[model samples]
Target chain A: MKNLLTSRWFGLFIPLIAIGFGFFAGALIMLISGNNPVTGYVALVEGVFGDLYYFGETLQQMIPLIFSGIAVAFAFRTGLLNIGVEGQLIVGWFAAVIVGISIEAPLMIHLPLAILGGAIAGALWGFVPGLLKARLQVHEVIVTIMMNYIAMHVANALIRAYFQESGQRTAFIHDSASLASEFLAEITNFSRLHWGFFLAVLACVLMWFLLWKTKLGFELRSVGHNRQASAYAGMNVNTNIIMSMSISGGFAGVGGAMLGLGTFEYAEILSSFTDYGFDGIAVALLGASNAIGIFFSSFLFGGLQQGANNMQGQANVAPELADIIIALIIFFVASSYLIRWIYSRLQSKKEGK
Target chain B: MADILQILYTIVPAALIASTPLLLTALGGLFSERSGVVNIGLEGLMVMGAFSGIVGTLFFESIGFGFASPWMGMLAAIILGAVFSLFHAVASITLKADQIVSGVALNFLALGLSVFIVREVFDRGQTDAISARLFRIDVPFLSEIPVIGPMFFSRIYATTFLAFIVVAIVWYVIFKTPFGLRLRSVGEHPMAADTMGIKVTRMRYIGVMLSGALGGLGGAIFAITTAGNFSAGTIVGQGFMALAALIFGKWHPVGAMGAAVFFGFAQALSISAQQIPGLAEIPQVYMLILPYVLTILALAGFVGKAEPPKALNQTD
Candidate 1:
C-alpha cells in the first residue's frame, strides 16, 4: 500500500488535492466578496446532487467533454497538437445539423444518419491539418488555428443561409421522434440526460480499445513516441498523423451532434462557439488521457458546471466563479510536475521511515 | 481612373486598422519563435489585453485619460498575460511538457478567466463600449497629399504608428543587438547556447514574456480601434493569424510586418468588397472568410521553404 501510494499514482493524487485547494481558494474569494462560502458550497453540492434534473444536466454537459476529451487525448497520444478541435467541432456540428434538418427519415435512420454526418464532417476537418502536417511539413498548430477561423466563418455563414429561419435558429428536430431519449431521463422527470451519454461512454471505451488493442493503435503509439524509429520499423508515419487527426475530429463532431440533436435540439446561430471543444482539452489533460479517468474527470467538471449556477443563485456569487475555478484547476493540473516532485520527496522520506 | 482610385483609397485605410492588431502580435510572436519557443498563448494574451483596455477606457473617457488608461489596461493585461504564460513556460520549459498542450491549456485558462471576470465585474458577458474611441491622427504636412496622402498618412490611429515603430525597434533588437543574437541562438540550439553559458530556461522565459507584452499591446489596440469595446470576439483568431504571419514571415521582424500588412489588405478587401461594383454580388461571408482562406493557401504555397528556428521543438 505504501509503495502504491508513493508510485506515479501520486500524479493523480495531486490534482485531487489541487481541487481541494481550488475550492478552499474559491471559498475565500467568496468570503472576501461578503458571501458565505459554506452556503455557496452547500448550494453547489445540493444543486448537482440534490435532484434528478440537475443530475441530468450534468450528464448532458459531460457528453461533449467526453468526445472532445478523447479528441485531445488521441492527438496527445499521437505526438500532435490539435488546437483546432474548436474549428473541427464547429464544422462537424454544422454538417450534422444540416443533415438532421435537411433529410426526412424514420427515427432509427435519422438518428444514425445525423451522428454519421457529424463524424464524417469532423473527420474531414481534422484531415486538413493532418494532411498539412504529413505532406507539407507545416505545423499542425498553425493549420488547426487557421482552420478554426475558416470553420467558424463557414459555420456562421451556413447558419445564416440555410439552417436559420428568418434569422432565428432552424425549427426543432422532428419533435419526440428526432430527439435522443435516455432511460435515466424517463426514470426521473424530463431531464437533459439522453442516449448521448451512453454514446459518450461507448466512445471512451472504443478510444481505449483503439489505443491499446489494435495493430493500428500500436503503430500510432509507437510513431508518437518516435517518428523516425517508427518509420524505420515500416510504419506509415504520415498516414498515422492524418488518421489520428481525422479520428480525433470525428470524436469531437459526435460530441457536437449530441448538443444539436440530443440536448440543445435546435441549432441557434452563436456569435461564438459553445466552448465544449475547448473545455475538452482541459478534460483530456486532467483525465491523463485514460478512458476511465476521462469518465470520472468529465463528471467532476460537469458537476462544477452544474453547481456553478447553484453557487450563483443561492450564494449571490457570480456563476462565472465556477469557470475561474475550473481554469485554476487546469492550470495547477498542467503544472503537475512541480506537485509530483514535492510528492516524491515526501514519499521518499516516508519510505525511509 | 476615379473608380480605381476609390477602391485603392478605401482599401488603404481599412487595411491600416485591420493590420494593426496583426502587426503588433506578429512582432510579438517573432520574438518568441526566433528564440525557439512557439508562443501559442498569443490568443489568450490578446483577449486579456482587449478586456482590460476596454475596461480602462470605459471607466475613464477623457482623451488624455483614455490614452493613459489604455496603457494602464495594457499594464494589467501584461501582468495577467505574463502570469498566464508562466503556465506554458513551466509546462514546456521546466516540466518538459508538450508545448502544444501547454498552449492549448493557456488558451482555455485565458478564455475562462476572462469570461469569469467579465461576468463578475460587469454582470453581463461583455464590457460597455468605450465612449471616447481611439481618434484618427493625420500627419501634419503629409495629410495634404492627394489620394495617397489621406490614404496613407491621414485617417490612421496612433496605435498603427506605434505598430510600425515597434516593428522597427524589434528588428533592431533582434538583428543589431547582442542580446537578440543570444536570444536567437537559444531558440536555434538551447544545448549549444547553454554550453556557451546562456541560461536557456531564462531566455525562454524572456521570449515568452516579451511575446506576452506585445500580445497584450496588440489586444489593447484591437479593442480601442476596431471594436471600441471588449467582447469575446475582440481578439478572436487574430492571434492565430499572427502565428501564421510569424511562419509566413520566416521568423523575421520585417517579414512579419510585410506579412501582417498583406493580411491586413486581404481583410480590408473583404470588407470593401461590397463597395466594389463587380464584387457586390458576392456574399458578405465570402468576403469575411477571404483572409482566412487566403492564409491557408499562402501557408501552403507562397510561404515556400521558410524554415523555423532549428531548436523550435527542442526542450532540454
Candidate 2:
C-alpha cells in the first residue's frame, strides 16, 4: 500500500489535482467578481476548439511556447534555473529578422540562414551567463536577470536604429525566408497558422533523443545532480554547463525566430517584453521539465490563453484571468506537500497511512 | 570636478526618492533570508502592493478622506502584501515546497490578480491616476543649512527618512535583540535551533510576514512618490533590483540601504545625464542599463562576496 504512494502513476495524479484545483480556484475568483463561472468556462472551451480558426490560433501560440518550454526544460534538467529565456528569445527574434531582411538568397538557404542566425544569437546570450557561472562563480540567476533588461534595451535600440529611415517596424521578411502557410491558414479559416508548428514538434523529438539517448545529455544531467560528484567522476562540469546553456538557448532562439519569420514577419520595437519567455518557466514546471510534458503543458497553457481571449470578447471576463489560472496551477503544484499529506490521510482511512 | 559636484547635488533628491522603495524592500528581504526562508516573491508582493496602493487610494479619496487617503491606501497595501505573502510562506515553510517555484507563482499571481481586478473595477487594464499624492517636504531647520543641507536634506520625500529609520530599527532588531538572535539561529541551523526549543517554523513565518509588510510598504512608496499611478509597467524589475541590493549589501540592513541608494543613484544618472557635462555624451542605452550591468559585476565578486543563510532553500 505504501508502494502506491511512490509509484510513477501517483506522480501523474498530483499534477491532475493541481490542475483541477487551478480551475476550481479560477471559478471561485470568477464568482467573487460577479461573473458566472459556468459561462466563463464554457466560453473558454469554445474559444479553444469551437472552430478551426480558434484551434489554429491556439496552435500558433503554442509553437513559440513549445520552443521556449524546451529551452527552459533543457536548462532545468542541467540543474540550471534559466530566468533569462525571455532575453535570449528576444535577441533570437532580432537576429532572425535581421538575417531575413539582409542578403538576398535562395529560399532553401535564406530560411535556414535566418534560423541559424537566431539560434546563434540566442546561444551567445545564454553563453554569457553560463560562462560567468562557470568561471567567476557568480550566480546565474542574478546575471540572467540583469541580462534580460540589457537584452530589452539593446533590442529596442537596434530596432529604432535599423528603422531610422522612416518605418514603424522592419519590412516584412522576404518570401524566401517566410514561414507563413496560405494553405494551412485557409484550412483554419484564415487563422495565423504557420509552418512553425512542424519545427516545434520536431524540436521536441530532438530534445527527447538528445537527453535520453546521448552521452552529452548524461554528462549534463550528472553535473546537474552534483557538480562535485561529476567532477570526481572525471566529467568536465564546466563544459557541460556551458553546452547545456547554449543548447537551451538555441531552443529559445528558434522560438523567437517563429515570431519574426512566422507570426508578425517584421521586427517592431520591443518597448516591453512578451510573456512567452516568462510563461516558459510555468510550462517547464507544470510539464515536470520533460519534453513530452512540456509539449502537453504548453499546449494546455496556449489553449487557456486563446480561450481567455474568447472569454473576454464573449463573456466580458478579463483575459488576465488566464494568467491567474496559470499562477494558481503553479501554486497548487508548489504546495503538493499539502496534497500528498491529505492523500496519505485518505489512504490511511481506507487501509493504512 | 565642479560639474561632477553640481551633478551630484542636483540628483540627490531624485536619487533619494527612487531609493526609498528599494531600501525598504531589500531590508525586508534581509529579514526573510536571515530567518532561513528565501523570498523571491518579493517582486510579486511589491506588485500587489503597488496595485492595492493605487486602488486603496482611489477608494479612500472617493469616500472623502482628502489628504489622508494615500496613507490609508498605504495601510491597505501593507495588509494586502502581507496577506498575499502568506501563500509563499505557507508553501515554503509549512508545506516544504520549492521556494523559488513558489516565489515565481506568487509573482504571476500578483500581476495577474492585480491587472484582473483593475480591469474589473475600472473597465481597463490599469488604474486611474492618483490625485492626492504625498507631496515633498522641505525639512524645517535642516533646509536652512548651507550647500550640503540643501543638497542632501531639502525637498525630500518623507518616506526617504522613514526608510532610513526602518533600516536602523531592522539593524537593531537583527543584531541587538534576543528574538533576532533566535531568528538568525533558526535560519542558519534549524535543527540546532529546534533542539534549543526555539520555534523555528514560527520564526520563519514571522520573518516572511515582516518581508511582506515592508515589501508592500516599498511598493506603495514607489507608486505614491514617482509613478503617481499604477499600471503593469509601473513596478517592472524594481523588486529584482531590491533583491540584487540585498545580495550586493551582503544581507545587512545598513549595507542593503547603501546598495539600494547606489542603484537609485544610477537610475537618477540615467534621467539626469543630459545636464551632467561629460556624461551627456554617453548613450541613453548605457545610462539605462547601468544599474543592471553593475549588479552583474557586483555578483561576480567585483564588489565582494555575499554568503546567504546556511539553511536557505532546504526543504527538509
The model with the greatest TM-score is 2
lDDT of 1 by residue, A195-247 (tens): 88889999999999999999999988898999999999999999999999999
Residues A1-353 of candidate 2: C-alpha lDDT, one tens digit per residue:
57767998777787889999999999999999999999999999999999899999999999999999999889988899888899999999989999999869999999999999989999999999999889877777778878888988888877787643346577788999999999989999999989999999999999999888999989988888899999999999889988998998889999999999999898777767887888998898888888888889989999999999999989999999999999999988878888999998888897843
Q: Candidate 2's error at B93, in angstroms?
A: 1.3
DockQ of all models, two decimals each: 0.52, 0.77
Pick out the ten consecutive residues of candidate 2 chain A with the lowest summed lDDT.
Answer: A161-170
* Cα lDDT, model 1, residue A91: 75
Model 2 residue A328 lDDT?
90
Displacement of residue A48 (Cα, Å) in model 2 is: 1.0
Q: TM-score of candidate 1's chain B against its reference?
A: 0.92
Where does model 2 exceed 4 Å of error? A163-168, B1-6
